[model samples]
Target: MSEPWTLHPDRALPADPTVRGIAREVYAATRDLSIVSMHGHVPVEWFAQDSSFGDPAQLFVVPDHYLTRMLVSQGETLPRLGVGSTETEAVEQDPREIWRRFCAGWQHFRGTPTRYWLEHAFVEIFGVTQRPSAATADAIYDQVAARIESPEFRPRALLDTFRIEVIATTDPAWASLEDHTRLAKDGYGDRVLPTFRPDPLLHVDRTTWREEIDLLGRAADVEIGSYETYLAALRVQRQRFVEAGARATDHGHLAADTTPLDDLEARRVFDAALAGAVTAAEAEAFSGHMLFQMAAMSTEDGLVMQLHPGVLRNHATAPFAAFGPDKGYDIPVVTEFTRSLRPILDAFGHHPAFRMIAFTVDEDVYSRELAPLAGVYPALRLGAPWWFLDAPDAMRRFRESATETAGFSNMSGFVDDTRAFCSIPARHDLARRVDAGYLARLVAEHRLDLDEATETAVDLAYRLPLAAYPAPR
Candidate 1:
């Protein structure tokens, strides 16, 4: 009978009868609140063109690094899973075969957030009633393929069905944002916005730095002959993004250091980097200086600054050379934010116009560093548990660790931070359930009234994100 595949109405609620009842009520109050995905990596072209997604494998397996990485860990090759290669001669696998491999390895995803999200998509989105396995793989695939062919499964229609009020896509600083402009013309402008991501430009040690600089210059219509012109070009690009409805700037540095450098030293390092003579230490110092500069720019422009630090990207070199970045080998490192961010905090921590949300994969810092820092700094807020920590238990640990000091208001509401467009609603729903369980416990213990928990649930699910990353007027 395949265990009778079904989504329990109270799947993530507390097990205790009283707490589960309280959680059910809490969830019902906020379950329908429109999603505010203030930060994510979904490509804007899908929505701009209202593109119909392809088969099940193409829609779910190929673009999601989470699924691909897990399958790779189980000894399945990326190419077999339909992951495209950078090399020109690689062969593409059949979609059905790729999906079969995924389904055959489905048990590997048990107790994983990927499983939760996939199951949600299978049942709620595609109306699948059988558990995915080698036996059910083809049938499930055919069912989803049929559903995807419908007009209701189109990208724009799915967004509407998901009740997504506003979503932001991470875009390069040098991007033309033509897709976003087209969305605006297509009357979906206010619903989808861009977020400025300038990590490549910040790290001068990269071999592609020079080429990226030239592209930035072309994009901003400014000549970048010196450090002054480079900053000018970046400023112009940020203004362009602002005009296109960007409300936030996203930085993904390997560390959270934000020390500033004197202009003379900065210009010297910039010149060396341009000459391809920069050393590792110099590049790190310059990147830190740029982060401080970004804060200053945020203060002037009123765009919320987001820092997601301490990720060691591309842990393996072979896959990177064969494929490309974001192939799911990024690992987390221990992060210390208190002293590292003192320089920026001292400068703009209290600035009214400057708002910064900090995200991390390191849980040790949740209460020890981030919560305390956000607790005192008026300009700082703690971003939701992200990346590897977006799972249910980790989300609960985040609330237990950070809520006492930072409170619900100092936390940015759940940000999906996904490239998989179909996983947005699932991810948000999981967060809402986890939060409801947390709040329900408080009510069960008589620590909070039901009314207060209901309001907080709605705020965490919807209102906080809009306030944290307001749309540019």
Candidate 2:
């Protein structure tokens, strides 16, 4: 028989009895709060059309880089897991086989956050009572498949079930946002919003930059013949996004540098890049300058600027060439935020209209760099432990490191930056549990009172995200 799978009510709480009790109280106080997903990659079309998801493998294994990357590390090829290949080649075409492969490698997820999230979904969302393994994979897949076929398991139905008050979907600068508009017309405007992501347009070194620039110009109905025109086109796009109900702009760059260049120098670099003659160093410099320009735009338009830097994307060329980006080869490197952000922060750190949230995968800079910066700058806030550091211990370390300096208010709150829609509730629940445990220890030590911890828990789970990324006025 397969081992029974169950979720303990007090899972993720402190091991000590007294602290555990305190944590339970704290968690219970805020466990049912509505989610405010300020930044994510979930396609808006899913919710707009209220689409029914595919089989278990399609929902769980195929799209999630978190699972695919781990399986890849264990000698399992991506193609075997239903991941599409870059070259013209056949891959595992059966969803059932992909599900079986995932189950067979379930042991590899032991002691990882991926295991916790998956189990939470299995027990709480799908009502699966048997542990996933090669022996029970078929049974569990059938059960999940049946559950998802029901109308109640549709994407819109699941959104309501997940208690998601609002979610922001990342869109390219040139996106029409037709789905977002449709949702708005359907009276779901208050619930779903768009986030502008201009990475492809900003990174001149990429081969797709020229195409993206043309796309942007066409989207904005502007002719971009100079650097000034390009900036104007970007401004127009931001306005379009704001009109479409976007409250934030998201940037994922290789570095956090935001130094501005003189108009002449910037124009010169733009011309070289436009001609496809720019060097790597010139591209890096131009990208850094664009960060400053983005901040300037945010100051004028009131869109929250979210910067997540230091990710070396597509570290391995073979897989990236065969597959596409976000195949889980992105790795974090040491990032220096303090000096790099000085130019932009110095320019608009105190501007009332400017709001910036800094996210980093480099934990070494949390207390030493991010907290200190956010603690002082009125416009700057620290984003939650993100991407690679969204695990249990890493989150605890973030709170311990940041709270003493920046306090709870400086936090942008828990953002479920995931493409896996069903995993949203599980990810947020884990964050709440971790925060409750952290606060419980503080209350036990008399650093905070129980009532205060309860209120803080609610804010961390719900309120802060709204405050950080408020609906655009």
Candidate 3:
């Protein structure tokens, strides 16, 4: 029988004798550093309730799009994996069946980051000694389920176990933030913070735009009559987020365009959108204009702006119609940052109070446009490899591509951008190991001293995230 699955001590390190030795030394310094997840999609309710994850399938299979998407590609249906059922499809109700399907397809995740993260979580978090397979699925589930029932596996308790110094949850602009308020009173306000995400509000062409606008108006306690009042209401909501310990604003638009329209044009579009008569071109223009407006707000409010563009969200209409968004149908397109972001960069690139981190699913832009732009812009730092590019080889390629021009300081370190709470530490661990391997290459080439590489590794893992997204004052 094959040996039980276990994480290798030097899993992601270089294989060359001298470089591998150097990587081991670099990894040691950052192996246990406190995680600073400045940006992610982890639900606030998890920490608010301090609840136990229901079971292995619920925790690992149901909510993780990364896991679900891979399974769907292999001809597995969504309902079988416990994804929400629709009228046309009946969802899987038995947790054991979902776990069995996941284990049977474990080989699909081979050579993927999901596999690395799962292995890490199994070996490190749950102390699972056996590999996931059809034969071992039930046994491993029993082992994990037994441990999860313990008090130590509770959401709040796992924060200490995961060594999460600070984690930020993405919140809609219209969110009440009552849970955040409760968390603040419970003394976890700073540890678990909120990030303002205004995507729905900014995209006027969405079918639910007017309803979202009303929700925003109610949340901010502002009566919206015109575009000016709408902006004011948004400002009020941003201030609310700030007071709730938010340090950053997250924007995931399809493009990086930041061109602002004239006052009259903006007013016209707002009125048209309110009346349900706005054109697609006008809606697109307004969203780009709002990005410029958001950059202005960031300058005034001291909230860092995180822009990750170039995703064509919900590429498959059938699944999207059935399951809704974030079911892993987002596809990357070629994005031109140099021309598209000039308006915002020219406006706030040198501003003292403004800060922005640019992330891209388009890795082709890393060396060509993003690195050069980030190298000189005082307000901008190129974000770490995001979404599809967050894998090990992709991360190594990111360092190779972005470091030449942007250097280490101009990079946003590692932002896991995950929604899976239990996978947080594993995701961060992968990034650190990848960075150590990259820095070891630099040290091996004599471009950086061993001491410099070691210190740089720590900064990438810890200091840079804090500096880029400072705690809200």
Scored by lDDT, model 2 comes in at 0.93
**What TM-score would each prediction reach against the true structure?**
0.98, 0.98, 0.99
What number of clashing residue pairs does each candidate have, in the order they appear?
A: 0, 1, 0
Q: List the residue pairs that clash in candidate 1.
A: none
lDDT value, candidate 1, whole model:
0.92
TM-score of 1: 0.98
lDDT of 1 by residue, 1-473 (tens): 44658899998778999999999999999999999999999988889888688888989998898998999899987778888654544645689999999999999999999999999989998889998999999999999999999989898988789999989999999999999999999888889999999999999999889999999999999999999999999999999999999999999999999999999999999999999999999999999999999999998888899999999999988777777898748899999899889999999999988999999999999999999999999999999998999999999999999999999899899999998988999999999999999999999889899999999999999989999997554
Runs with alpha carbons beyond 4 Å of true place in candidate 3: none
- Which portions of model 1 show Cα errors greater than 4 Å? 1-4, 85-89
Query: Model 2 over residues 18-71: C-alpha lDDT tens digits?
Result: 999999999998899898999999999998898778899999999999999999
User: All candidates: CA RMSD in angstroms?
Assistant: 1.3, 1.1, 1.0
Better of 1 and 3 by TM-score: 3
lDDT of 3 by residue, 1-473 (tens): 77766778999889898999999999999999999999999899999998888899999999999999999899998989999786778999999999999999999999999998899999998888888889999999999899888988888898899999999999999999999999999999889999999999999999989999999999998988899999999999999999999999999999999999999999999999998899999999999999999999998888999998999999988778888888738889999899999999999999989999999988889999999999999999999998888899999999999999999999888999999888899999999999999999999999999999999999999999999998544
Cα error of candidate 3 at position 95, Å? 0.7
Count steric clashes of candidate 3. Answer: 0
